[model samples]
Target: MLNTHLIMEQIRYHPIVATISIAVGTVLASEVIWKVVQYFRSKREKANRVHEVVVFNELGEICAAQHLWNTRPGSQEPEAAHCRNTHCTLRNVGKIAEQIDRAVYSIDLAIYTFTSFSLADALKRALQRDVSIRIISDGEMVFSSGSQITMLARLGVPVRVPITTYMMHNKFCIIDGVERVEEIRQLRKRKWMRPCYSIAVSGSVNWTRQGLGGNWENCIITADEKLTAMFQAEFNRMWKAFEKTEASLIQPK
Candidate 1:
């Protein structure tokens, strides 16, 4: 307490000491501020990367993909045995249609928004090959502008919509193939082709152009028989609610 005079004398003469003290204080403050900013930035980035369930209220201008939703930006199509968790981009969307194109006995599917012409074309080919097919979509979005639901309905593929106060936000497709060699031969004899395997796909992705070609989406495809059957059963149950013979020009025998 009695050294005030001495302390003042030392600080006044050692100006370099004062400068160094000020510089160290500034660096420490800057470091703290940088750390705080980095913490917040990391939180914001993680939130942005996380996918949340979106409740689509109305159909916007349906167009090509303008956003990306892949967790891995440049990942490739999943390998066969490993496709159980396959994530897909816009270009990989055609594979879904291709799977439908390969359907042997039937293609049962439901989607929230049906806007992919490529998928509609695949269904068209399935119909031409006499494959039993049914589609269910959201009552609101299915009839909206640019949705290919009408195109599919006009082409005589069975299409149904559940009238609900809430959104029928579901998307899945199951491809049923011949389970037996005799069934495969029987279909082949009729000029119909069956995929060597059966598959079912389900995920956050819709069949819309925005879902596949523009927005962030993810889906998993599997050859698991039990899983495929479960999905098929769900489709059949939903199909009955709005089924009509006029829904298909070619009645399923």
Candidate 2:
């Protein structure tokens, strides 16, 4: 049987024993408090997690069909004829442009047809901000009327044409999260936590006025890591397969 009085007397005689007991208790309590804090923090982070998939349709009501239709030659019908008394508000172009504008580090675009002035302006702005941009475009389409691929190249953006007899019919953009990754790394060094953000926007919707507002097209914007990584891999592969020489728009042939 352990004698409590005897134990107390022994501890009193050896102050180090009592000190050790208090230190051990304090350490256990701190560990329990830290675990509770971590539990609540995890719950909060899960609640605020930002994994999303957004779908955009060109023929949808959100698209401004009237503006796009007016841009078409010989389509001089009244605005009411386009939307049938509904508001012709085109938003998909702006949405895609907004995605480009949000890039902090880099943008990899592999597009079939590139003509939308809005999107070109967005890319120009991103370039002005020192954001790295690489474009892989269909060879024939790069020379098509109203194609912005050459214009982007003229602005010093690296543009490549896939060397294939068939068309490079991919319409996708990868928004890299390099800046976010660096931020997370710095935060972790300081014992902080943050979720990284990266995304891929892809679908049948080409970066064109007709595709964004006139045609029946669909595109998806997703932040899934797996999908982004796959798209990144494909972009890297094409970036290599395409000619190493950047296209020159100073003198169009």
Candidate 3:
């Protein structure tokens, strides 16, 4: 009986070991939760990478502004003053145009359509500055004048409209190696006529002024290396499949 009582007393006093084990278990559980959260946060699995991008600065703010068009109704423009500072919006395409015009080394642009006068002029100006330019468009979906392509080519911009089975529906630009899409990256090095920065934009906006002025489109403009590298890889892959027999325009050879 005495031994039994001693054993009971020991069990009651052994709470320290139980407490330590519980504490260890809690710490391990916390670590597992943290790891799980990080895993979901880092792994990218979707082309629609809207969630991956976040507003970290003024440039990010503009991108969020552009994305608002996707969330809001109609072709109405988001109020830039109210939007975050970095998010790109349809109204801010002019800013994108300006960046293109300022490109010194190289420009790689892919779009579904080309008709925006402002953007066309920007590309034209870039060519005149002797900036190396490569442009690709959906030859099958010529919604507007190939003025941007033609102008760039005439000015020595190496342009092509690759015919593809999937509609070549990508609309993007890598100016001085920056990727414009939120969370996407662009990677390439094009020597410029001047040593200036480039701009990249991606979203629903087309090259037409309508897309910029009145159409509902989501877009982001950024110079972040991490983001642009992602886009560059995609552009490179798509460009590889582009037919070499084609000119920038779909006109007869």
For every model shown, what is its TM-score relative to the native structure? 0.55, 0.63, 0.53
| lDDT per residue as tens, model 2, 1-253 | 9799977886889889878987898999999999999999888855533354334443345534445655657653223333442324244455566678877667889999999887898998888887778888887898889999888877777777766699889999987644434543575585543343577889887888677666766677776778887888888788877765344323323
lDDT leaderboard ranking: 2, 1, 3
Error of 2 at 126 (Å): 1.3
What's model 2's TM-score? 0.63
Tens-place lDDT digits, model 3, residues 1-253: 3587765665588978757766898999999999998777555322212222212223433355355655556644444444544444433655666568667566788888877766777777776776667777776655355456665555555556665566778888777664322122223443332233435677776777556655555667766656667777777666666757355463522
Q: Mark the 10 consecutive residues where model 3 has the least summed lDDT.
A: 48-57
Per-candidate clashes come to: 4, 2, 27
Candidate 2, residue 107: Cα displacement in angstroms equals 0.4
Residue 65 CA displacement from its true place in model 3, Å: 23
1-253 per-residue lDDT for model 1 (tens digits): 5497876776799988867876898999999999999999877745433122222222221212232232246643222222322233433565576677767677777888887766777888888987777678877787788877677766666677776687879888877733332344685686555334567878888877667645666677776767777787787677776665234332233
lDDT of each: 0.65, 0.71, 0.61
**lDDT at 62 for candidate 3?**
38
